[model samples]
Target chain A: MSTLEITDLHVSVNTEDGPKPILNGVTLTIKDGETHAIMGPNGSGKSTLAYSIAGHPKYTVTGGTVTLDGEDVLAMSVDERARAGLFLAMQYPVEVPGVSVSNFLRTAKTAIDGESPKLRTWVKDVNNALQALDLDPTFASRSVNEGFSGGEKKRHEIAQLELLDPKVAVLDETDSGLDIDALKIVSEGVNRFASKGNKGVLLITHYTRVLRYIKPDFVHVFVAGRIAEQGGAELADQLEAEGYDKYTSALR
Target chain B: MTVTDVARESVASALEQAPVVSHLNPLPSYDLADHPVPTGREEVWRFTPIKRLRGILDGEPSDARLEWDTSVPEGIEISTITAEQARELGELPPNERPAALAVARSGGAALIDVPAELAPGEPLVIRLTGASVDDLVWGHLVFRIGNHADVTIVLLHSGSARYCATTSFLVGDGARVNVVSLQDWADDAVHLGRDAIRVGRDASVKHTSVSFGGDVVRMHANVEYAAPGGEAELLGLYFADAGQHLEHRLFADHNQPRTKSNVAYKGALQGQGAHTVWIGNVLIRKVAEGIETYEENRNLVLTDGCQADSVPNLEIETGEIAGAGHASATARLDDEQLFYLRSRGVSDVEARRLVLHGFFNDLIRKVGVPSLEGRLTQTVEVELAKTVLAGVPLGASLILPVEEVAD
Candidate 1:
């Protein structure tokens, strides 16, 4: 079992003007088998928290402590964090023009596992994962996210999540651009991953619709670079009805 | 004035009023005296570092010998013929000094002839290995493809010597030919070569040049149609490492109506002093109506301190052509690509390697030689390894100062 603990995490990003603080004293803890949903309005630091945990170069951790089962996650490099069983489903998945999906997946797997996977079973596993996400087996030969649709991109992330099987997944707005059918497909994929019973899910989203499919054990209402309130899944429903107005006004 | 006289006068005036726009000068002569030695000021020799040419432009001759081998399939003829005998087949006029010198010095030429209506089962292979020599070596070669014949020729160069050569092709009516000329010389070798091809009626020719080694290698390939319904495709691939100079210049003269030409060249440069030059010129003459032509060049800079020069020129004497266009681009690795790969757990080095491979993959596939594909891929991998180590570190560090990020 793995536990992710983020305490007093202060992150800032450099802009044209100067260093701008994005996440101000945000703290959260997620243990194995728990799903925590972070909902917020635009520019409320939800994605910042996700990128910070994944060690994106753009976000500087000014003052924070992030640990994975007592291991110092903040001290690790981006790839090291990934090898330590942390994954980030980016909001905007990048397009790599010439690298095929199969090659990228295999290379990532090899890097994470510290050895090359057996080719015979690996190909089968990749095909099965792609099929599970409603992606064509031929998609493996296509360049990584080069010309994929929004729904396809989200589904590919879920497929990767299932195949990589990280201990913790910080999904940043994976359901934002998905339609109803795509939302269901992606939610089911995430739910299947959660059902594994040994992973932690930190789902970042702006709407409560995805929460309807993949129930969150904990819901945090984020405002002004910090979590203003936290409660059980009922809090998501309350925010759904009331919206972020209450939190934003209270912060003001 | 009479009606006929008035009509003729108007037509003559209209023809006189039309502006004459020349895209390229007329083809130079093969006689050494007809062309003056270049002082590097001429447009054709401006990009070349002429001083390093070791006086070859001044008609310098070397006593060095090159080891030659040919592997031909049955029914194909190969023989060595004196320069006098070669002239009987056809007159191959040189357009530049190196070509003129090569023709003047080469006592004999290696001739490869394919019979009419015969399709070769396999590609004919020619291997020319240069011994380590300081003297300048000159060579001349001729390829004659018979009517309706189809063949592929592979010319491989290796080892070390200062060399200059000219290769000519005579494509018969309705014939199809593909020629791959690879320049993989030693680090100290300097090579200058010219390829002149004459495409006959309804014939198709594809010429590909691949350059990887040599301190200084410059190749000029020109194509002209002997009759209408001819086609030519010129493709080039080059990689220049530190202190190496590799240049490829191409000209396609559309002198016959209904002919077609296409030119594409791609290159990669890395390390300090690594330079590459690509010049593509296409001229559509007034009589060459209903012709189509396009040229494109792209370069990838793997590190700082390397230069890539690409020039595409199109000169149309008449506005009646079907289509004419050209494009060129030189760029470094995309930062977003590197970030995307790194975010997926690929190390910086591995990510760069993948990007370089992808950049060259499409061009390499166009060669279509199955036997050489694997070796070329491995060669690129090895080249990347050597240059990747000495270049600017791949993928910027995450830690950024206030000043650094602001800019």
Candidate 2:
């Protein structure tokens, strides 16, 4: 079984004024067959944590370390970290006009698996994944994320997560910009993937609406780059009703 | 050592060899010397480096051809156009000759001509090999697209050679033609070439050019939307390495109303002194009301010493045109774009190639010829790998070597 462990990880971005801390110190771990949710308000470093863990160049690791199954993940390059069984579903996936989503997903799968998949099996797998996401097969012909509606983009990410099937998945604000129908469909796809054997998920979001559909095994509150509170499903419900007003005041 | 002296000498030599030559001939009237170095003064040479072109003016033209590999598609017929054949077709009225013609004499060169109205299954391929030689050599290709016809032409240059070339094309009324040019020369050659096209009424012309080699190269293309309702599209992509300089000058004239012309050129430069330049000049004449014209040039400088310069100019004499504008931007690779690809398990080298391929995808996919576009993509990816991977920060691990990265 694989596990993604973040040990007191802190991140900062090199701005014109110098390094400004984004994630103060985020520590969490998600083991195989588990889905963990990190809920926080705007600027609470939720997305920063997602990007930092995914090895995005803009997010610098100021301190601490991220490890995957005993390997130092933070020391690995972005793609290396990814190939080591990790994935991040970006909130604002870029519109790559020349590459089709099918092409991108297959290429990613090959990179992770170190070889091309059997043609018929790969086709069937891709079709099944797209169907699960309620996407047309024609989406294979369209450029990756180009001109896709907000809902379509989210579904496309889920489609990738389903097709690639990484050991660990980091979904960064995947629930944003999605309608209720889209959210339900997207959640269903996530649920299906989460049920797969030996898979881990780090679900980052600000709202509890998504948690209602794909229940997270653990819920953590992120504030100023660190996890300030840890609890279970009821914690998400409490935040949804009471909000982060209490957490913000306590952090200050 | 100015361009004028060289042009004058070339023209004088041609005159001495021609039996019907006259001292008062107005056909070669555009004197390279009399015209001030095109310093963004002319609308056509605006986006290109006016000063850097000075290096090409004094350099000796040679007939040198290197022995690098050449790739040409199979099945397409290839033939050289003879002087006799050109004479039989009649002279291209004085007004139709491009300014580059003053240096291109008819007898010393060979021309590739694709038959009118013939659509071959594969692209007509022309491979020009050059090596270091003292004498100047000229090559001309005349492509005549007959009414309602369509075809594709691929031109590849490889080897160590220093020479200048001229390509002239004419599209008959209502004809459509697509031409793709790829110049993948040895890293140690000097190259200069010019393209001049004439579009007839209701004719459509599409041209794509990719440059990936040579020590210094300057290419100029002139398109005349000579007839009403004619459409012309000129797209180009180039990658330059250290000590290399690439320049492009484009001219589009909307000579009639309801005509359209679009130009977009993008380049990536890396290494020390890798300089790239783009100059676009468009003219919307008084009679060209309702003409639609757009020009855009974007560049990516991936290294500290690399440089890119772009200049766009629009000469609109009337406000009747529906659209006329130009856009030019130069920036480094987008970190976000790279991160997005890398996060998908694509190694740094592969990730960069994917992003670059995507950056040029809009144009390559538009080439409309799958095999040809695929080959060009490979050619550019190879060139980009040499410098892009080398520039990566130390201690940074990459998934594949620059050469191993594929699209």
TM-scores for the candidates = 0.88, 0.83
Please give the RMSD of candidate 1 to the true structure.
4.3
Model 1, B1-407: lDDT tens digits are 99998997676456445432233543566578866888788888889998887777777656666898888977789889887776677644777788888888887888888898889879999999998747678999988889999999999998888889989888999999999999999998889999889898999999999999998999989888889999999999999999999999998988789999999898999878999999998878777899999999999887778899998988776678889999999988776666666666766677777777877776788788888889888888878878663445533422222223334
Candidate 1 docks at the CAPRI level of acceptable
Go through the candidates in order and give each one's C-alpha lDDT. Answer: 0.85, 0.74
Candidate 2 local lDDT, B1-407, one digit each (tens): 99998997777567445532422112323244443334454544444444533334343443433332434334323356654464344323322122343233434334444455666666666677776523344455566555666677777777655556666677777877887777777776666677778887898988887888877677777677657989999999998888788888777867679999999898988778888888787877666789999999989777778778888878775689889888999987666667787888876666677767777887887877787777877877777767665556412223332112211
Point out where model 2 deviates above 4 Å: B1-122, B131-133, B139-141, B389-407
Ten-residue region with minimum lDDT total, candidate 2 chain B: B398-407
Clashes of each: 0, 17
- For model 1, the chain A TM-score is 0.99
Q: Which ranges in model 1 have alpha carbons more than 4 Å from their true place? A: A238-252, B1-26, B80-93, B200-203, B227-231, B255-262, B284-294, B316-327, B389-407
Please provide, for model 1 over A44-71, each residue's C-alpha lDDT reduced to its tens digit, 9 standing for 90 to 100: 9999898888776677788878999999
lDDT of 2 at B205: 88
